[model samples]
Target: MTAPILEIRNLSKAFGPIQALNNVSLIIPRASLTIIAGPDGSGKSTLLKCLLGLVRADAGQIYLKGQLTDKNFEQIRSISAYMSERFSLYPDLTVEENLDFYACIQMVPKDRKDDLKHRLLERTGLESFRFRLAANLSGGLKQKLALATALLSSPEILFLDEPTPGIDPTSRLEFFRLLEELKKEGRTIILTTPYLDEAEKGDEIVFFHRGKIIKQGSLSDLKNQFPLLVFSFEPETNIFEAYTELSKLVGPENLILRGRQLKIFVPEGEELIWRGKLLRLKREEPRLEDIYFYFERRSEMMELGHDQ
Candidate 1:
């Protein structure tokens, strides 16, 4: 059996009184896209920073490439590139110049800089906009340029924090396509995003909430293991009013609003009760979002039980 490319064991971190990560452990395979997904302050970014040695964990061990080294961070940083939530590019620099600058920073040899720069430009589809100033580029193009810079070093592992937040859907799709290309080139990519739909594109997903991993698995594995039956329906009354009324009847955790449609998760044999209250009801397959919330609510209930 092949070993995991990266292994994190019993990782934990804290900030003053707040615990940022709690006994987190994960295994990442080579050449795969692993998404760390959760809401804001869920410790997704903290996990990435700890792995890259930007933030020190209070406890736990990180192993890379089947070995744990004394200079763990130094070795990891050498083979990794991180693009933070606020990836900065020189606004005044043209796209080509920006790439050139990062290439120099990554210490790409003088003899190979131009070839590497050109390849990245072509790969990111930024060759035509090479001469355009970074500040003038659209949000999506700006993100592409940031990715190009991160790739300048040809690092084996890429870490991205919320790389697609607020971008247009078209650009987000383009960015994901580039990631697929990188995976084909045998690069391990670990990223964090708040969007559950975006997390669907990952080879594996780790779901975090309030500094703990609630669940982790491949998309299909998660879907297959989901225990509840889901149904979508249109409420007969005003959507907001129906949601409020239904929350009292079925508990808020079981209900979700998707535009004008309502999605509810119920245990076995409880579908008929909800069906009577909603219109146009139909059984639906569970999505990533549904699975996430299911686990999240379970976690909350477990914690609540313990507290009581």
Candidate 2:
């Protein structure tokens, strides 16, 4: 693994009775993209905010570039950029104008400002849309502008919180392509996303659930660790009806319905039963969603046991 750019240890945060983060610790590798994946209300957003000092962690320390800076994040923030879940740039400002505004805010050197702006605009494919108001741009273009603005500082690490939600697939693809280029240029990216499909593209994934990281690893590593076999088949009957029937045989938590296709988790010793019930079932590789669902349920079960 590459040398770590950021190290977080025993981080915790709370909002009154709700614990937003619970004893979380993670090492973010240098020059690679590490995805924070989880559902809403999970600690993904809170974790990012804590790292950037937007929200203070109640406990634990954050080390940036191997130097502890829990009390002051200025040094870390200086070398990093963040794009919030919401579009933070001025919607009324033209794309180019927003870039200029952020550039000035980041204090880009006068000699490098114009050149950097021009290059980012071209790189993000926003050169032609430079004169368009941010509000007038499509969902995709707005995101592009936001990204270009974030890059104005030429950050070493970029933190994005759900950058692709509500974005069209085509635009999402373009946005990720730009990220890949950034990674190739040796920039570390830490992104929080609810979409597991998007998380699949990262070098490492940190899976969170209800204020804690339940799993963290590379895609293949996680897949190899998955203990259950996934059997998928298109239901001959109505999907929901089939799902209901299967729910009785195998818990609903073990089933995933995708359109007309039904996927079931076949336990180590139950392959024969599943295969007998679904004549056309085929064993398939588990997708990232499958892995997440499995871990989330397992975590919930363990929590229930502890409570009991």
Candidate 3:
């Protein structure tokens, strides 16, 4: 509210006949952990690149600190750290070597270098692997080193592209632990992930679909906007047949199959008969995945997506 740290205005981009991004606008409050979620090829990467000026927008404006200038582009680049889904890390270089080289290039001072390196490695849990060549590390450890390198200069804003996609779940948990530390240090973090369940972790979230923002708000705010409640069912017979039959009563558009069970949104007053037919039905807590899928289906039914 007090002048967003990052402001995007009417951003648009296209790749030939396919529009990679439509007119999109968003504001990232200072020191917020913002998560961007979308299906594959929905323009998540393009949006990040456009915001960072790595990819120019066809028509839009990006303002940082209330200042906009094409000439000082590199200066804006300096205040941010980026790690792509396929991050660039030298396979042959030792983890320590990569950190030292990155620090030197970023002009991190010698007097503070050791302290900074130790802190990052400790935070990312890469301290023991520092002497190991990056190529020799496991997928999860390599990701930690790549993230550590990005943190070398302690940029005020961090941009990541699914940095934990292939890493083990434990490693992904550790990665977010590092981000939690950054949050305490007052760093603004924004990243994109296809995993819908992770959306609940952010202070604010923007949902990207078909190159536009369908929803953006704090998790509680977004969840409150939906007028649906979830009911879970466990079948005594075939789960598939039960789901198939229940799909008719509840409408396939509103059901999400999870394992042998399903989470359904039962419209108010349209529930008695449906509840009577179910072998076992219970009210359940609504997870972020439920919230995301509900809107995605709603958007499809509306035949329109929300953006700027």
Candidate 4:
């Protein structure tokens, strides 16, 4: 892995009675797609905000290119682009006009601004709709425009917060295609996403829960680290009865019902207990969803055990 471009040491934050982030630490390698994956209020957004200086951390330090830094992130901001959760575009402005507005803000040289804008419009497939008003554009187009504006400065590190939700599937696929192209150009991309299925695209994933990081690693590495063996089979009897019976044996946390098929994860040697009752039983590879749930369940159980 390349040397770290962004590093956080013991970061923390709070909002009134809620602890938004707690002693969180992370390392983002240069030119890698690092995903922050978590549910709502899991501190994913807060961590991003802190890095961009939108929200101040109550404690901890942020380092840029291995250099310790103060709260003022102006230096970091100079080399970074951030596309927030909300589409921050001027509804009254045309697509071209919005690009012009952001170009001025990013201080792109007048000599190169027009050429860069033209290329960005073509790249994002917005050239034909350049004259269209922002309010009139579709959700997907608005997101594309937002991305175009963020690239106005040609930032080294791009931070995106849940950019895929609410968009159509085709648009979502296209957006990721664009992201893949960006990654090829050696630009570091950090994004927070709730969609674990699409997370395979990332070089590394940081899973967060309840204001803490549950686990962080590459998909294959995390799967290899998983302790359970996954299995699936079709039950000869009613699926509901099978589900209930299995739930009683191994708990619902270890079981997933897909139509007539039941999938489960159990410790070594435990599969023998239910093997005789199952029909067409097959061993299965652990999926990202299964791995995430395993870590999440373990974290919850540990917390419960600690509280007692």
Candidate 5:
């Protein structure tokens, strides 16, 4: 593995008596798209703030690109671009005007500004609407504009918080296309999102919960860790009622209903494994969502002293 682009060591922070980050430590492999996956209030946003030096840590050290010094703090700050969840765009400003305004703030050179702005607009599918006011843009377009502004300075690292929480399906796909382009250019990215379905899009995932990292690995590894024998069924009866009836036998934790299909978690020692066959199951595959819940349950069980 190449030297870490962002190295966090013993990083801890608190808000009065509430510990936001608990001795959190991790490394962002250079050029890798690392995602800090967790539910809301999981400290993902707080962790990002600490990395940007926007929030001071009570204890710990951060190193950017193998160098660590207070003198280089300002330099390190300039090398990365950070985008928050609620992207701020001037409602009255045209798409092009917003980009130009951000470029000026980032100190983008006059000679290079036109080309950069045009290219970003074209790549983000905003070229046709370049003259449209931001307020008139859709939720997706606003996000793309935010990303475009972040890239205006061409920073090496991009830290984004839940870039696609409430976005439409089409917009989410488009944002990922832009992410793929950035990934190909060897850019380091760290983003936080609650959507487990998006896990496959990242090179590595940091599964976080309650300010703690419960799991860290690639999507495949996480899926493999899911302890369940999945089962799908399409019955002639009420599907929800079937789920409720089966819940008594296999347990509610074992059943996950997705539209017309269901994924049942067969405990290692439970008798539900054979019941799945007797009950007539279909499409059998462990998806990322299943794996996500599996880990979440495991963490909860661990917390509840189910395992020591």
Candidate 6:
């Protein structure tokens, strides 16, 4: 059997009184896209930083290529590239210049630099904007440029943190397409995003909440493991009125408002009770967001029970 490309074992970290990571362990197979998804302060960034050796973990071990050694740091540094939430490319330099500067800093051999630069520029669709100043590029274009710079070194593992936050929908779609292309090139990509739809694109997803992984699996696995039945309704009356009535009947924990529609999750065999209370009700497949919230709420309830 082939070994995983990257592995984390019992990893933990803390900040003063706050524990940032709690016994987190995960495995990344070769040439796959893995997404660590959660909201802010869920330790997504901290986990990525630990893998890059930029943030030291208070406990646990990291293995690369199935080997755990004291040289793990050196190995990871040499073969990995990280694009943080704020990748600091020189604002004054042109796109091409920024790539060249990073290539030089990474000590890419002078003989191979030009060919690598050409390929990265073409691959990232930055060829036309090569001479454009970094500060003047659009948000998506700047992100593409940052990715181009990160790729200059030709690292085997790529880590990204919230790479698409606040970008327009069109740009986000384009960026994900680029990532799919990179994955096809046989590089292992690990990234974090709060966007559930974006996270759905990955081969495997790890859902983090409050310093812990609540669940990890492919989309199908997640849906199968979800413990509730979901139903969507198109109300005949005012949407807000429908929501209020449904919230009272099923409690707000089971209800979600999506534009003019309302969705509710109820236990098995309880669907009829809520279906009778709304119009145009239909059983629907659970989305990644629904699955995430289910696990998150379950974890909270479990914790609360233990406290009591």
Best prediction by TM-score: 4
Q: What C-alpha lDDT do the candidate models reach, one value each?
A: 0.89, 0.89, 0.82, 0.88, 0.82, 0.88
Error of 5 at 136 (Å): 1.4
TM-score, candidate 2, is 0.90
Error of 5 at 205 (Å): 1.5
Model 5 over residues 54-101: C-alpha lDDT tens digits?
A: 888888888887666342367666888888888778999999999999
Q: Which ten residues in a row have the lowest lDDT in candidate 3?
A: 271-280
The alpha-carbon RMSD values of the candidates against the true structure, listed in the order shown, are: 2.5, 2.5, 3.2, 2.3, 3.7, 2.7
Off by over 4 Å in 6: 69-72, 233-253, 257-261, 271-281
What does candidate 1 score on TM?
A: 0.91
lDDT tens string, model 6, 135-199? 99989888999898898888899998989987899989998898898899999999999888888
TM-score of each: 0.91, 0.90, 0.88, 0.92, 0.82, 0.90
TM-score of 5: 0.82
lDDT of 4: 0.88
Q: What is the lDDT of residue 138 in candidate 4?
A: 94
Overlapping backbone residue pairs in candidate 5 total 0
lDDT score for residue 210 of model 3? 79
Whole-model lDDT for model 1 versus the true structure? 0.89
Whose TM-score is higher: candidate 1's or candidate 3's?
Answer: 1
Model 3 C-alpha lDDT per residue in residues 1-308, reported as the tens digit of each score: 36777888888999898888999999888888999998889899998888877888898887887766443467667888898887678889999998999899989999999999999888787888889998999988988888888899889999988777878888888778888888788899898999886767789989988788877888888777767768887666787887888789777767888897878887655553554652345777777778778777777766643432
Model 3 alpha-carbon drift over 4 Å, by segment: 69-72, 234-250, 272-281, 304-308
Better of 1 and 6 by lDDT: 1
Tens digits of lDDT, candidate 4, 1-308: 44589999999999998999989999999888998898888999999999999999999999999888788799889999899887778999999999999999999999999999999999999999999999999999999999999999999999998888888988888988898899889889998989898777789988888888988899888888888888886887888988998878887678788878888888877644554553345888998877777788778878888999
